[model samples]
Target chain A: MTANARANILSRLRATTTQGSFAVPDAPVIAGLALSLEERIDRLRRMLETMHAEVQVVSSSAWLGALKARLRARGLNGLLYGAETPLGAALEAAWEDDLPPLVPYSESVEQCREQLFHIDAGITTTRGAIAENGALILWPSAAEPRLMSLTPGLHIAVLEAGMIFNTFAEAIDQQAWLQEGMPTNALLISGPSKTADIELTLTFGVHGPKELVVFILT
Target chain B: MTKTADVLAFERNVTKALDDGQLRRNLRSAMTTLSQRRRALFADVEAFEKLRTQGQSIRRRALSRLPELLEQLEARCTANGIQVHWAETTAEANAICLDIIRRHGAQRVIKGKSMVSEEMHLNHFLEEQGIEALETDLGEYIIQLDGETPSHIIVPAIHKNKDQIAHLFHDRIPDAPYTEVVEELNAIARQELREKFRAGEVGVSGVNFAVAETGTLCLVENEGNGRMCTTAPPVHIALMGLEKVVEKLQDVPPLLRLLTGSATGQPITTYFNMITAPRRPGELDGPREVHLVILDNGRSSIYGDPERRATLQCIRCGACLNHCPIYTRLGGHAYGHVYPGPIGSILTPQLEGLDEAGVMASASTFCGACEEVCPVKIPFTEILRMLRNEAYARGESEHDVKGHGYRYTTVEALSWKSWALYNTSPGLARIGSQILGKLGQHLPMIGPLKEWTRTRIPPPFAPKSLHQLAQERGLDDDR
Candidate 1:
């Protein structure tokens, strides 16, 4: 039945003769494509901050310490991280007894769904960032599950400065996303979850993370 | 659910909407803020026009090859392990969804913001089958709670103010406190919907853009509910109008930017999720199964006509709704369709036919504000005029629009035809005006002018015809 329906619809569309072939135009140049690395970082930070997300620029050697300090300062109980990655291993190595517990996403969502929803914060490493819209591109994998940047109340993302692109098209092009098959889910997260649904009042953290803190490894 | 589809009922709804003080205030403030934000975001006129042209061309290209692109999209999605289904009508689409749910044995279905689902009335259909469908978007959730259809497209609950929402939450939710704070109200909804998301067995969503090259479904949302509904549930189903398909992966960014910026004046939404396939092997978390349902639902007819196919170029941004003077005055409820405002004026008539919805085409004032704000540059004034023409003259031409000649009446048609004839012949015109100038004001209010005179004072006609006075003054033939 469905096959017949598909054939009928397609045949109807094909039967109708339309005029003129649509010529696909060349990709227009996007703004902010010519900014320096510093300019790009500045643009991203300003835009994210306007949306109420926090950003901190620190050296790769100091991001973990900054992450710990920021989490402690916010009084978050535990920080969720992926134990399979190098950054996760480094955090695990630098663990201190008095610091907040670092919870690793080691189990399937079915087994850890309850804990994930109640966790204080979850941090994941971003594949890259878009400076034009102030967004972080995430390619969720098995190690860092899709929910790491979601589910938790506070989401902390780690981005290297060099990975920042001036626009989303640039990120897609530089990463060769067309050549490489897209992951099950690819996301561009600009700020924490928000809505202006109630009388156009801007409210954050309606469903996803309330706070999105990015640590740019300079 | 509730529908005000017929011509009389639509006019009645418009009258009632126009009289509602609270609704008027809410719509006025909301529309102003939305249009202001969009203008502020696209402040650079030159840059904005360039993006609009590029966006329009992209949509035109996709629609020009809609069938081929849809086929490519299906094959690519199937290769990516995502099941694709086709439905020629809304009923078929609903049945396909129900079948998917039955196969999964899913009792709880959570949905993100989907206008397509609303068009199918999927929630109402599911309830009859003893399945519960929960709305996860905050605006949709509010509307679902009250058993009301969405008034606006992007913001479903834009017609309600904070105080109304506060009262609603306090009355509806168990042990909920009455609070007018926006943040608190949002938190209450978050808490209520989170449990549903956690337990949702099947997730349903609307695809914003489906890429033919990568077979990806892109969803744009500011709230995280879209993510939860698509990601947390074991089985995910996405519904889309066949027109939503795009050409390639690169076609996404430009459209996405225009969509979010024009829809909510956001540079980008909080989340732009691209779903290529279901959970891959060894994937710890993601939907186990993904299904894409492409629905025609009168769109194929709209696509058949070369001139009318521009209707499909709309990205459902709601910018037209925000800027329309008629929409702002009467609100979306007056239109009495799933879509409202200028786009609805042309779309509902074509989709539902002129017999049931032809009156909606006359709802516009031909202000051209909708065309000015449309991201894809849909010539709305021209389309509305075309639909109006089809409504009155459906039998006059071989047109694909449904319900042609629905509004055509012998008396009205004859009156117009005679009026056209009188204007072309000076002898008949002078004779007609001589009679009208003598008895026009004293004649009984009848015909179409009967309704016009019921509200407005009739204008007095001069005793002397203009042509008579011109000849009395000895004016030349040219004058």
Candidate 2:
């Protein structure tokens, strides 16, 4: 039945469709912002902050120290992270005897359901950032997965300053994620979970992370 | 599920909607904020115009190569371990969704905001099969609880004010105290819908954009309910309009830019979840089984008509609705369809044909505000005029025109014929004016013109015809 339906619709479309090439456009740069990379990153910082998401940019030499200090300030004690990512291994290696235990994402949704909800914060690496929109692009990997960013109360994303693209189009095209087959899920998170459903009034953190704190490693 | 789709009953519905002073106030305030926010966001008029042009070209190209794109999309999605289904009508779409639910034996289904599902009235269909489909989006949840369809696309409960929602919550939920605070109301819904999300065996969502190259379905939402619905459930089923597919991943961002900006003036929505495949092996958390239903409920007919095919470019942003004077004045309810406002005026008829939803074409003021605000630049007013012409030419008055029945009835057709006769002959025009003036003096405001004159005074007929006066003044060419 479904096959018949599919063929019927496709036949209708194909009958009218012309066989031709198309113009694939370049990702246009934002017209007004004639700024350099450094300037764009600064603009991203301000934009994210305006939306109530905290953002900080630091040099790679100071990246680990800055992240640790920020997490401690937020009182995010328990952490679930990807065991195989570069940042994950570094954080695990840096853990001291007195620090909170590091938990790795489970291989299945059911296997980690309990730990996912109980964790105070989850950390992951963003594939890239769109500076113009103040968005962090995170392509879920087997190790990082979807729940790492979704279930935790606080999502702390680590992004490289160089990964920042001026527009989402630039970020998408530059990455060419399709070349290696897209991950199960990829996310472009701008701010914390929010809703204005009730009488059109804005309320933050309804379902996903209540707070999204980004650390940009230069 | 409680559809006001009898566009035939538009007058009664509009009367009821207009009587609710609270609804008017709510719609007025909401529309004002949306428009103001949008204007402020696109302060650089040139930048905004450039994006719209780019967005339009992207949509146009997608349609021009739709079949190949759709075939490629289906194959890619299948390769990604996602099941693909085709639905030629709303009935087929509903049946397909129910079959998926039955396969999963899913008693509880959490639904994200999907206008496609609403177009099929899927919730009611599920209810018939003894399955509970819970709306997870806060706006949708409110409307669901209230037994009403979403009045607006993006803001589903834009029709209800805080006080009304607080009352609804207090009445429906046990232990939910009466409070008009937005945060509190949201918290109450969050607590309720979250439990459903966890309990549901299946999640259903609508697609904002479907990428053919990547087999990725992009779902955009400010509320994370969409995430919960798609992520928490073991099975995720997405229903999309056939026209939502884009040829390339690059095609997505530009269209998305217009969607979020024109929809709510947001730089970006909170979550832009791209589902390229179901949860991969060894993935900790994501839907295991994914299905995508590409639905064509009269969309092919619309596609075949080249001039009007631009209607397919709508991203369902609801910007045109926010800016439309008729929509804001009457609110969505008065339009009497699952979709409403300017887009609905043309779309409802195009998708379902003019017999059922044709009355919507006349609902617009043709102010062209909708076209001006449309992100993809759908020439909405032009389409509305085209639909009107189609309806009149076919004498589709057999379909109800509600309170303004005369507009679509034989009376309207004869009125045009008579006017054509009078215009073609000057003697007939002079005589027609005297007769119309006599009729005007004696007649009470009645028929289709009654609705118009309810709050307006009819202009008195001229004592003499302009053509007659032109002839008398030896200026016959002016006639």
Candidate 3:
């Protein structure tokens, strides 16, 4: 049924034609996507490493200390991310105490969806990995709304060691919900929010999260 | 209406904008904010590149078969009770809009932010025709009130600071107090525009994507102003550039995703209004009459030209503006045209004529960054290069001499023998460089060289060229 739906969508798209008043490129001569899964992952990892270097990382407890240190170091308020329930608690406590704006995670995906609309940060779990591209498949369950992954300035993702797969297709295959006829909305996040908007001036954080952090736990 | 003569006059305007530190600060800050937001949103989306490729392909397909799809769209729109008008030029487009206004007896027009309208200078034309046109978008309204052209494609009043806007509002509204708060100012603008929307007899909007399959016009906006403009007024007129047509409705999702994501870094904008026609009999709210004016305005001429046609793929997300280094420093006013940044550098010359806006071609650093971030993959740098060649062909090569009075006429304008003699011979070129270097040292700050020396010193000639050095070093001796 899913395959049939996808085919229907593709056919509908192919059949539709635009006005002949403008010039469009001929069908894209797609150079084969040459990079292997491992090469893709390495490229992504390198990109992440560069991004991480720009940010000051803190343990779940040392978030406030890290924030203060980052403020002193960069002369700007740094984004905060927490790991688990304790991190959420700390963020909530910080918000109450008027520290820095910390993005909090919810147990319920629907609640996460609501929070996603107005959040400064997004926290989600990576279900699998794509080796060719350093892509993490974040399953958009009820707790992890797709918007949460988009709207925030900072994205803090928790990746359990065992859940990482080699490719997007492999990750999809592992999803029991797909076999059970459940809908899936997945996000693959790699880096911080960035735009080459000015004259190709690389500006960080326009309408989305500027910083992306992934916490890998064994 | 021909901006050919005004291109030279824009230098003085650019000088003024350059001096205004406050305006520069506002532009820099706003662009920075928008850029960062876009980057963050795209970071996690692996399919972003794929989506961009898809968008490019879809737009290309649409453009390749535009005439047929336009007919289909016209048929569908007319069947759906919408009126379609084809305009060959800006004047024709404006006149058509004015005729619609006259037919409706509309005294006032409420407009959403439409770059096409700006390109046509529709507001000024409408005011001259004795009809009041109110910009409903907050940023556009601010610029309209100031009697200024939009500085940025996405954020029209991006050059205006909060305090400046607050002051403008205080001056305009009798009882409104000055406030530095942005949200407060937005609320005030909303209040001011709401009244206009309710009283407005006609609404004018720009189409983001026109679906040929269903004759649907899609509008993506953060504010509900577009919704108000399209629905509240009795007559709604959608001004679409001929290039905005897309083949199918499904192809719209990816393009919309790219537009909103690239523009505001949101996965989707607050409102995505897709209107096929005027409200049907049972509809409670919507325009009674829908008029879609498909404006050619210099687009059809470039349609078959392979080198220039890629300009049509632009989605106008303003991502290039946000990330542009030159735009960050000089601001949009430096280009002295409606569209600015990488897109503007290539587009302005094409639409307005290369000879008319030749100076704008030099505005780029050829950074290739615009191409990198472009959702539609418009090779802005390559297009700018083409425009530069075109500009030179039209005798606008004075700017290309690298310094004042260093005319390329001796070689470029003279015989092909002169060009070949200077370009092909390595020994002669080296000797010339050596002499120039010596002269540069001896001639103490004279002529056009003075301006060149102010920012950078010309390097002395080396005994061996880099190619020679590489060859001596046992590198590939291709040179």
Interface DockQ of each model: 0.67, 0.53, 0.04
* Model 2 ranges off by over 4 Å: A14-34, A73-77, B1-8, B395-412, B426-456, B475-479
* lDDT (Cα, tens digit) per residue for candidate 1, span B1-479: 11233767887898899889999999999999999999999999988888988898899889889999999999999999999999999999999999999998998799999999998999999999999999989999998888898999999999999999999999999988999999999999999998888888999999999999999999999999999999998999999999999998988888998999889899999999999999888778999999999999999988888778889999999999999999988888788889898888888888888887888888888889999899988989988888888877745555657888777778888888899999999999888888988888788878768989888999898888878888899997695
Best by TM-score: 1
| Candidate whose DockQ is highest | 1
Candidate order, DockQ descending: 1, 2, 3
CA lDDT of every candidate: 0.90, 0.83, 0.65
Interface RMSD of 1: 2.1
lDDT by residue for model 1 (A1-218), tens: 69988998998888764453334454455564679999999999999998889999999998878877766656677889999998799889998867779999988888989888888889899999999999999999989999888899989999999999988998999899999888899999999999999999999898999999999999
* Model 2 steric clash pairs: A109-B284
All candidates: interface RMSD: 2.1, 4.4, 13.7
Candidate 3 wrongly placed segments (more than 4 Å): A1-218, B1-15, B394-412, B415-419, B423-440, B443-448, B463-479
Grade the docking of candidate 3: incorrect
| TM-score, model 2 to reference | 0.91
Once fitted onto the true fold, the runs of candidate 1 whose alpha carbons sit more than 4 angstroms away are A17-32, A73-75, B1-5, B394-396, B462-479
